[model samples]
Target chain A: MSDLSVDLGFLKLKNPILAASGTFGYGLEFEPFLDLNRLGGFVVKGLYYGPREGNPPPRLVETPSGLINAIGLQGIGVEAFIAKVLPKLQALDTAVIVNVCGASEEEYVRVVEALDAEEGIAACEINISCPNVNKDGACPAFSPESTRAVVREVKRASRRPVIVKLSPNVTNIVEIALAAQEAGADAIALVNTFLAMAIDVETRRPKLGNVLGGLSGPAIKPIALRMVYQVASRVKVPVIGMGGIWSGADVLEFMIAGARAVQVGTANLVDPDACLRILGEVEDFCRRKGIERLEDIIATVKT
Target chain B: MFKDPEARIVGKESWGDYFLLTFDSPAVSALARPGQFLMIKVSDEPYPLLRRPLGIHSRKDKTLGVFFKVAGIGTALLARKTPGETLDLLGPLGKGFNIDPCLAGKPVLAVGGGRGIAPLYFLAWELRALGASIKILYGGRTQADLPLADKLRAEGFDFACSTDDGTVGRRGLVTELMEDEIKAGGGSPPALVCACGPDPMLQAVALIARDKRLPAELSLESRMGCGFGACWGCVQRIRRDGKAEWIKICEDGPVFPAESVVWEKESP
Candidate 1:
């Protein structure tokens, strides 16, 4: 049998499959259907300083194969999450990676500082590329300077490992990845949702209430894979790949392409038990291939 | 919520390319309401990664029936199954129609078009038992498209029928038939108009209710992920203030008041 354990400097995962933020909804939501402890880890939904009701109506639109959403980062905020959501999540056996988002660099630091004080939070993933929020014209993680500054500040404020989630809507993702690595980011999660929009042609109006939305699913798989390959080759920190991963074969493809760990996002939207199914398939694939450890597959590109 | 470990396919019937599947899931039956639906994984394969959403037609004992059209690979697989087979199901989800107040000795008109009639049948049955005066208005492109006409007639419902081809009853849209009913009933209108159909049809009925000043409610359909509030996949636009607010149709409603929906010339 193949061993699926992996190490990312400060944190360790039993396997390479981790639930992406937003899709998993703080781990508690999936507890009824999924065994949270069996998988590697889960990244909770993005948190802000204050409670937010999020954007207005028509927040989501279904495309031919995927979905576009403009949810506006609606959440109960850091204080409530710590008080209510955190305690329940902490009880789970899985490693917890809280995803933090903010309108300004200072807000990011403040949220990180609050989370650092909480117990059972294994790490924090800095989301600098959420397309839903309007306070920031574009996510700060899109630019190298802003990405570095946010990473440096958060790393300075917390002792926990900070994983900077990079946006795919950029001129060169490697530049942003390298910048995060240089500024003391413990790891990097590549390819947040691509900026997109849909139209109700008959009405000549935008389908989503926000007019613009973030696209995720099988439609963006090729782009996400290419970006992961690009960033993994350029950055020294471990890379967590995401976007359109539906099965174990897709996970292996991401591992071969270069991601040390892969997160399942849109697939969870389609199948609530997708993460568990994918994890089982990965173990079966490893056993069938006679692989001894999951680390042997990371960044193992074939000519 | 307990998982239905046994993927038991309790029953199956064919309606053209569509299939009416009944599964033995005590968990789903125990929780399901009249208009809620289930997300069924037709195949364990990854090609069709998402489960197809199907409305719960009826629930009895420990079994829940789902009515679906074979529009894709998932439905096609479901149609091929026998009564003894098992299919994976996750369900009894989404907010159903509110039948309590409407059933208080009030005259209720249940309107449906095409496959949309599935959920309304259960609602009508529940209303009848509650002693509400129930009238069913069914519309289809042709007589053949009316999948449950015989079942409705057998149920002894006071019904009106219309078809686009003039094959069965009136030769216009179901709305034309509804107009006559509204005229005869005078300005008071029926106690409520409960409708479920295509988006265009629902939009038309909503407009009629607004013009006639009739109390109306509708069951809306959208592609969903979690079938619960978590994924935010099945969101619909509703006017809260002067602006629009996104609400999860699966949770807040598959049912909404007619006045709240902002219907466009096209769906946006």
Candidate 2:
């Protein structure tokens, strides 16, 4: 069997398939669907210092081969996750990555600090690029300065390896990735959903309650691949590519484009067994190509 | 427990815009309960990314049925399926109706509206088998929408229907027929009220159940991303342990106690 394992420098995964944050919930929710041990890892839903009620209804809309959502990062808070969720997750064989989120920089550090005290957390994905919240202003990832500041602070507060998840809604995504890398980010995850909106013609109103949401699915795959290629070529840290990944071929394409690993986002919402299915496809492709180590393909794309 | 499997279509029936497709999916069918639903992949392609959530309409042995109307692109695609086609389905997901033993030998009211009538047929059949006397109240916009009325009656189910245009059993809302039934019963009113329909109709049923002091259960509808708990796309404001909170409709319930539901118009 072809080895599907991928090492992200600071964190080593059994395979390259990870259920993305916000899409996978707490990992416990998917216990009935598939074995968590079979997956490389899964990033849990975003958590703040305290519980959040999230945005109002009409939070999702389906576009052509895509879904736009503005869930506003509703969560049970970091402490609650530690108290309730982490213990259950400690039993699982898969890596548990906690996605840390906050409205302000201090809140981000606070969440990371809380998580730093806990065991069983493989890594912390610092989410400074969530497009659904901070409606009037740009997210931290929008600017290299803010991105650097937040990533540096989170890295300082977090003992676990920090993965800066970057947003695509930027002029220079590579600059942002470099800033995160400079600020001590161990890895980079790109690109968070593209900022998008849809309108209802009959009602003359926005489809989502938050007005705008992050668009993910097959619709954004090509652009995500390009961004991953650009940032991966520039940044020294490992890049976790995601956006519109639907199949095993899609996973290999991202790795070839320069991503060390890949996260399965919108596909999880559509197909519950997407992680394993995509993993199977990856194995089958490797077997067909007579490849032994999956890592041999990372950043091997021809210009 | 739920199963994600490609179920072969064993039966297919169409009545205008409404269609019923039965599948030989033993894994999901054997676990089917009234008010539960299936996340059906309507297309083989990725044009429609999310699966359509359809309620379990009927179950017999290793087969389960789903009845839906051609309301949107997803349902429209589902309606075009043939008897031999295989459907990728995830089910039977979510908490179904609470079949209390206390309901046995008791009078139960099953209210439905439009395609919302999908799960009520299965619910009534189960209630009847449990020795409870079941009365179904089905309503639609017109005669064409009440496609299951004749079939349900043919199966020896006690049924009543209503249409907005007055082309069917009653000229008013199905809630009106329910009120009439309750009023006609005089001293022997229904012990429980169960409803699945449009939000407004469900609200009306909740109000009716409240005024009559009867226990009620309502199957709600929401635009769902995942028919499981992952996406947190479909949420409803519900009161749990005397405190109001947003609950995942896909997992916490597609079925919930009437009193716990906080309606859309109501302030939290």
Candidate with top lDDT is 2
**iRMS values in order, in angstroms?**
3.2, 1.1
DockQ of each: 0.31, 0.76
Give me the candidate number with maximum DockQ. 2
What is candidate 1's CA lDDT for residue A275?
Answer: 92
Clash statistics: count for each candidate: 4, 1
Error of 1 at A3 (Å): 4.6
I-RMSD for candidate 1 = 3.2
Any idea what lDDT model 1 has?
0.83
Give candidate 2's iRMS in Å, 1 decimal: 1.1
- Summarize candidate 1's per-residue lDDT along B1-268 as a digit string, tens digits: 4346465878877778657878789877888777777777766654455567777787778887877677766678778888888877777776787778646687888888888887888788778888989899999899877878878898799888899999998898888888888897775578889888898899988888888888888888776666756666566777776776667787677888877887656443
**CAPRI classification of candidate 2:** medium
Candidate 2 lDDT by residue in tens digits, B1-268 = 5655678899999999889999899888878899999999988778887899999999999999999989889998998889888899888899999998788998999999999999988999899989999999999889999998889899988888999999988899999998999998789888889999999999999998898898999999888999888888888889989998778899989999999999879622
